[model samples]
Target: MKRGVLLVAHGTRVPAGVLAATCFAEGVANRLKAQNPLWENVLCRLAFLEISTPDIYAVATQMYQQEGIRELYILPLLLLSAGHALADLPRIIDDIQRDCPHLRVRMSSPLNDHERLVKIYQQHIHDALQQESGIDALLFVNRGSSYPHSYRIFQQIVQQTSASFPDLKKTSAFFAGLGAGLSRAFHRLEKSGVRECLVLPHLLFPGRLSAQLDRQLKEWAMGHAHLHFRSAPLLGESDELMDVYAKQIVLFSLRRAVQTV
Candidate 1:
């Protein structure tokens, strides 16, 4: 069966977000080229859940009718395996499967890849801290979710990353939900005598949220002369991330082939 891949991300309204998602999809495709026997001829495409062009439903239909794809595999680019990953995406996949009953479809999640992401984040922090030192506190900020399990997992990952920096006093805050937000995190850190702080925004790519965070950081810095913040850049199309992602695609293909047999 001819197979194709879909990389689905939570869509962004900003132009930079659109470009990042598109470029990352292309990068994933290039990295997988001839890397696996089963995936050698496979094609990868990108789609978004909402607020972006070329939604998942449209892309899947095009792949089936235009590109003659018989088997499809979906890889969600969402970091947290919350409502969207668990509830919303499955419904979309079900709709696609129903519309094309003959098409074989499988989906995968990146929820278990926290360790890999943390390694990347650590490297980013190390690079950012090269010019400055005495950054004794880390405020890891996440997108946050309403789901309990997802929220717990986010905290767990924060703790896991914190373990690596024994010297830095670490705390986490969420961008949404009931958890402590950005302002609260900053105030907490400031009161705790964290003079030099590293504000790590654990975002995958650039978007409105990233821009908002930048503005907020600037606003906070202007008011607080006592505290200094060095922000680590958001995740991008890194070679290391793409290499593991390509292997993930290959591994999924192998497993699917065996199951069909």
Candidate 2:
């Protein structure tokens, strides 16, 4: 039977948010078809948590009922397994499974612990660093969470990337309500004999937080000559990212099949 893939994301109320996520889903589906011709039969759907069309259950049920998809795998378009991925998503999936008993549901890991993810961020910052020579230090910033486990991944990325540019000072900062604030991080980098700083956003699209980071970084640069700043481009539907997502999806599906037996 043909499989169905649902790309679930913590959506935004903004129209741009939906468009970006949909583009990624389309890209993944296209890439999968190219690699495996049989994958052309796979149905790819985008489901949102808050700010987009077709919530999780709606999308899952549609695939189960209308598309005749017997096996469904959820590819969460998130980086960390915080509340949304850990608690909220499982509850949602459980409720959906009750309604569609014949549906074989599985969820892939969030886009973490994957080297391609590291490479994507690495490329984003590397490009920004090349564009602006004023960037003396780099900050791999993210939409943070209270969960310590999630924040540690940022540290790992910093450690791995710091070796590449020994001359530049680097740190990890969070925009959400956790860890060191961005302003504080900027000041620290400046005080540590670092004249320039680049903020790499760990986001997928140009959402509210991404816009705010751009505005804040720009504003921060105006006052301090030693603190020049540039924001990294958000990770869009690139070939590398698609490869990572597709791998996780296939792994999750195969694992689900094993459990059923």
Candidate 3:
């Protein structure tokens, strides 16, 4: 049976965000093709959940009808196990399966709390702060979620990252819902006499939210000249990130093959 790999991400209004997702998917596809002959014939496509074209349902239908792919493996590019991963994605997949009962659809786990991902975060933070000195605190920001599991994963990442860099005080905040929002978190850091801070956004792509955070941090920094604040770039194309994607695809494909056999 012909196999297809569908890489899905939370879409964004920003063009760069969509491009980042597409580039990452392409990198993974290229790596898969290079690593194994079996994947050479595999059809890989990128889709989004919202705010982008070629949504999941439409892509799946096209693959089934036009490409005639018998099996598909969905690799979610989300970093947390939030509403989209837990509820929205499954519902969308269910709808797709109902429409094309003959096509087999399988989903891999979200990119949450993996060791490789933690390593990526650590590398990004280290790279961002390498030029600066006297960084008292590092506030790792994420697009927060209401789900308890998402919170737990975020905490896990914070704890692990803190341990990796014991010298710098590590804290976390959310852009929305649960935990301290960005402003409150920054206030607490200032009240605690954190003179220099590295604000690291734990996001995969550059989107409107990332842009807003950048602007807010800059504006806030201006008011408090005494405090030094630096915002790092979101996680973009990187060799390590591509490795994580390749691993996910290989593992998912192996699992599906075994189950089918």
Candidate 4:
């Protein structure tokens, strides 16, 4: 039975975002072929949930109709098990499976509190601070979600990550929310007397949001001359992150394959 790998991401209109997500998908595809025996002859491709070309439904249909893929593995390039990952993707998968009953589809869990992610987050903190040492605060930034469960899961992840450093104070603010947004987050930080801090954008790739974040931080920094805010790099084409994704997917898919055998 032929197999296909579909890598899905929350797409964006920005060229940079598209490039970053696509490049990561391509790299993972190449790595999957070279590294794993199961994926050696597999067709690995990228599809977006929205905005960009080749939406998940379209791509999945094409994979089955053209590629003759009877079995499929879906790797969601999302960070949280929020609206997109938890609901939208699954709905589409259900439809796909309904339409093609013979097409066996399996999806991987979101990168929620993965051990490797914690290590990556720590590395970002170190890279952002460099020799500048202190128990300075940390500002965790993301696109944010409205779902209560999403909020709880993310807060838990933040709490666990912040515990990595010695007495490192941290705050999480969303780019989408108005009340608990970045500006309001700054107000909270001010009360806590956070002088120096590292702003980590919890993102898989660079996009309009990250660029906007950089600009906003610069502007905010200029207004508050007394404070120091540094923005860390997004979880992009780094070897570490890619390896984590590929390893996790391979292990899960291979296990499923064995179970069926």
TM-scores of the models, in the order given: 0.93, 0.91, 0.94, 0.89
Please give the lDDT score at residue 66 for candidate 3. 96
lDDT of 1 by residue, 72-130 (tens): 88888877778887788888888888888778888877635678877877887687668
Candidate 2 residue 43 Cα shift, in angstroms, is: 0.7
Better of 3 and 4 by lDDT: 3
TM-score quality measure for candidate 3 = 0.94
C-alpha lDDT values of all predictions: 0.81, 0.78, 0.83, 0.80
Q: Write the per-residue lDDT of candidate 4 for residues 1-261, one digit (tens) a residue.
A: 889988998888888889889889888787778788767888988999988988998899899989999998898888877788777888999889888778989888766336677788888787766767753899888788877777776677677778877566788889873227888888877778888888888787777788888887888889888678876778875778887778767887867642120
Better of 3 and 4 by TM-score: 3
10 residues in a row with least lDDT, candidate 2: 252-261
Count of steric clashes across candidates, in order: 0, 0, 0, 0
Best candidate according to lDDT: 3
Question: What is the alpha-carbon lDDT of model 2 when measured against the actual structure?
Answer: 0.78
Clashing pairs in 3: none
Tell me the spans in candidate 4 whose CA falls farther than 4 Å from its real position.
Answer: 177-179, 257-261
Provide C-alpha RMSD values for all models, in order: 2.3, 2.2, 2.2, 2.9
Supply candidate 2's per-residue lDDT for 68: 92
